[model samples]
Target: MDRRTALKHSALIALLGIIDVKKLFAASGNNSEIRGFHKFNLGKLELRVITDGHILMKPVQPNFAPGISSTVVEKTLDANFASKSEVDLSINILVVQSASRTILIDTGCGANFGKDSGWLTENLVHAGIKPSEVTDVVISHAHPDHIGGLTDKDGQVTFPNARVYLSRIEHDFWMSNSPDFSKSKITDEGLKKMVVAVARKNITALKPQLHLFEDRAEILDCIRIKLAPGHTPGHCVVQVFSGQESLYHVADLVHSQVLVFEHPEWGFEGDTDFELAVKSRRKILNELALSRALVFSYHLPWPGLGHVKKQGEGFEWIQQPTVLPD
Candidate 1:
């Protein structure tokens, strides 16, 4: 090789040694990214949207947002100013401090799926609340992402002192001998079985601490379970009341902030019953729009606190601005 080429290669290698590219990438992945947790107060209640982690669903075609053409999906994403190639689904867990009870709405994806997720325990610690400090864990459904975090990889209970709560119907659906997913859009039997196995494993592990409540049961005199089945047999939303202020925690009602809001009738591939999911989405979105109450969405952007506004034929999510602490 020529002397000039050798000199250039040597300088490049020297720069690489000084730069520490691995450390730069590591910092980009961990330290440089914004922290996940958000805390605020609602009336007499202290509320927080803790981060669990996130998943990016790719293809954005028939699987991610079913019952629509790829062209339509592309147009919708363009209109919403989101990436036209992928769908971003964030796992935002709701934490409510009611009286002496520390209530957690849903645990995040624990040791499941990808490495980017399963950060619930770590993030919760960063939020100044230990898993043991959680007095109550209210589960919205039996989905893996919602209940998988209840236990660690070794099948150890994460919240040792917390009493787990879930709908009786939801518990039975997964615990039943034969789970019927005939109405589901997902046609892969093996994939469905894996999902069922995860739910059953997590639910069974927490059975001792699990407290099954009837639909619409008001537990702790502050949290009300609103029956919004469709995503699952026993899927529901939560209504948290404090003094005169209220926070309606709509768990997994809308996966996409813009697409779901723009077309409530559309089907999500994850929904067990697409038709029922659409109905529930429309019902809750309409009620929220009319009441103008605060809504907490689990799958929207981080700290998914917002209000629903009725648009022409559908609804729109109006994200609530973060208020600074005094």
Candidate 2:
């Protein structure tokens, strides 16, 4: 080998030696405890975002964004430096503490989904919250990921002491003996069957503690349930207000932070009614953008708290900077 080539190789080896291998491994390791929770104040209420990890899913064609072309999807993803093949859909559990109660919105995917998820309980503990301490489990919908953590592997209730709340329409649709599968636009027969079965099993297990409510009802003190039923028969977004400050927990209205915001007309595969899903998304997104309200999106990045802003014909997600309470 030439002297110049040897010198270059030696320089590279020296640089590698200078790096701390152990520390590098530790930094990149999957330490769930450290990445588990985030807390912020909302007036007198304390809001916590408990992560249940994330699922790496391939972006399905047609269903991912029915209105947008494949070329557009590829270009947008590439521009964002996101993987064209797959995207990580994060499962975030929202916790709210008021003077009267401690409410949890949406349980995440349980152990049955995959190993990549089901860390909600572990993270809750890391956040200093006991399952029993949770006064209410307000479900945004009965989708598997949102309600899967309601029961444990033994088919027992996870939050033993908390009262379970869900939209009446959502509960009825899932519990129905004959649901109209045509509305969902799901071509995979096996996947559709699995979703129905999971919903029935989980909802049945929580029936004893279930408290179903209608739209616009004040389920809790300051938290109101707003029916946004396009994702499912009864998907709902929660509005939590204390004085003039408020936050909207928009569950599944926008699946991908980039795709959904940029093309509100795009449809998510999980939506039972694709057209309705788009309508609800556009309506809610417009209102949220106009009001400039802080939002908590379920499938966005971790902590999922952000703001919607108008961008040309569509919108954009502006993630709130992480700030801890005093």
- lDDT (C-alpha) at residue 153 in model 1: 87
Q: List model 2 lDDT by residue over 153-222, tens digit each.
A: 8888999999999999998998898767687667888888888887898889988899999999896777
Global fold similarity of model 2 (TM-score):
0.87
After superposition, candidate 2 runs with Cα above 4 Å error: 1-35, 60-63, 323-326
Per-residue lDDT over 261-306 for candidate 1, one digit per residue giving the tens place of the 0 to 100 score:
9888876778888889989999889999999999998988766888
lDDT of 2 at 296: 93
Candidate 2 minimal-lDDT segment of 10 residues: 19-28
Q: What TM-score goes with each of the models?
A: 0.87, 0.87
Alpha-carbon RMSD to native, per candidate? 8.5, 7.8
The lDDT values for all models are 0.81, 0.81
